[model samples]
Target: MSSIDIQHPHTLAPAKARKAVEEVAKKLAERFDVEYGWVGDTLNFSRSGVDGKIALQPNQLHVSAQLGFLLGALKGPIESEIRRVLEERFK
Candidate 1:
């Protein structure tokens, strides 16, 4: 298995950040077949070949995902896309 972990800084208020993440989650669901929901300030998400959590903090967003064998092969691109989206959203 491979791992995709990313931490990003943000400037939005908690509520705005939550909204931004939820929107990103929806987009991810469409592309990656992921399911996600909030548990306190964290968003937990998963699919058949992937599981992850997005931890929303006072000044940062921490994302961690574990990919099963098949999906693991695409880790590089996946991580890149994640970083791209995060950069776009947090800007």
Candidate 2:
């Protein structure tokens, strides 16, 4: 299994960050076949082909993802979609 970590720093407050995280998680869950949960300050998820953590901070957001499928199979598209959604929601 390979992994990719994508981080985005936001200028929002903690409350906004939390909301953005939840929104992103819900969208990702609905769009992809993944299981996600909030544990403390981090949101974790795993599907048959992918696993990752979405860590939220007051001024920063970190997304650490692991793709278990082939190198170029599912990683690029999923990562792109995740990035787009995060940017759209958090900005």
Candidate 3:
């Protein structure tokens, strides 16, 4: 499997962060056929062909995603799309 991880600081409160995470997860789940959930303050997601986790800290958010496909198959585009969604929703 290939993995993509990203972490960055944010200024939002935990509640807002959690809400944003849920919103993003829902969108991803619907559009990408992924399953997502919340574990404590973290968001966990997995799909038939992918597995991943997204966590939110007081000042930062971390994302770790793995794709079961070949590295050249879906890695770059998937990661780019996820990053774009995150950037749009979190900012």
Name the top lDDT candidate. Answer: 1
Judged by lDDT relative to the true structure, which candidate is superior, 1 or 3?
A: 1
Candidate 1 ranges beyond 4 A from true positions? none
Cα lDDT tens digits, model 2, 1-91, are: 7777888878888878887788767876897766889899998988777778988877778998778756437777767987887787776
Ranking by lDDT: 1, 3, 2
Q: What is the TM-score of each predicted model, taking all chains together?
A: 0.95, 0.83, 0.88
Residue runs of model 2 more than 4 Å from their true location after superposition: 70-72
TM-score: the better of candidates 2 and 3: 3
Backbone clashes (count) for model 1 = 0
What lDDT would each prediction earn against the true structure? 0.93, 0.79, 0.81
Candidate 3 lDDT, tens digit per residue, 36-60?
Answer: 8778888899877777888998788
User: Which residue pairs in candidate 1 collide?
Assistant: none
Q: How accurate is candidate 2 locally (lDDT)?
A: 0.79
How many steric clashes does model 3 contain?
A: 0
Candidate 2 RMSD to the real structure: 1.8
Cα deviation of 4 in candidate 2 (Å)? 1.4
Model 1: worst 10 consecutive residues (lDDT sum): 26-35
Once model 3 is optimally superposed onto the true structure by TM-score, how far is the C-alpha of residue 64 displaced, in angstroms? 0.2
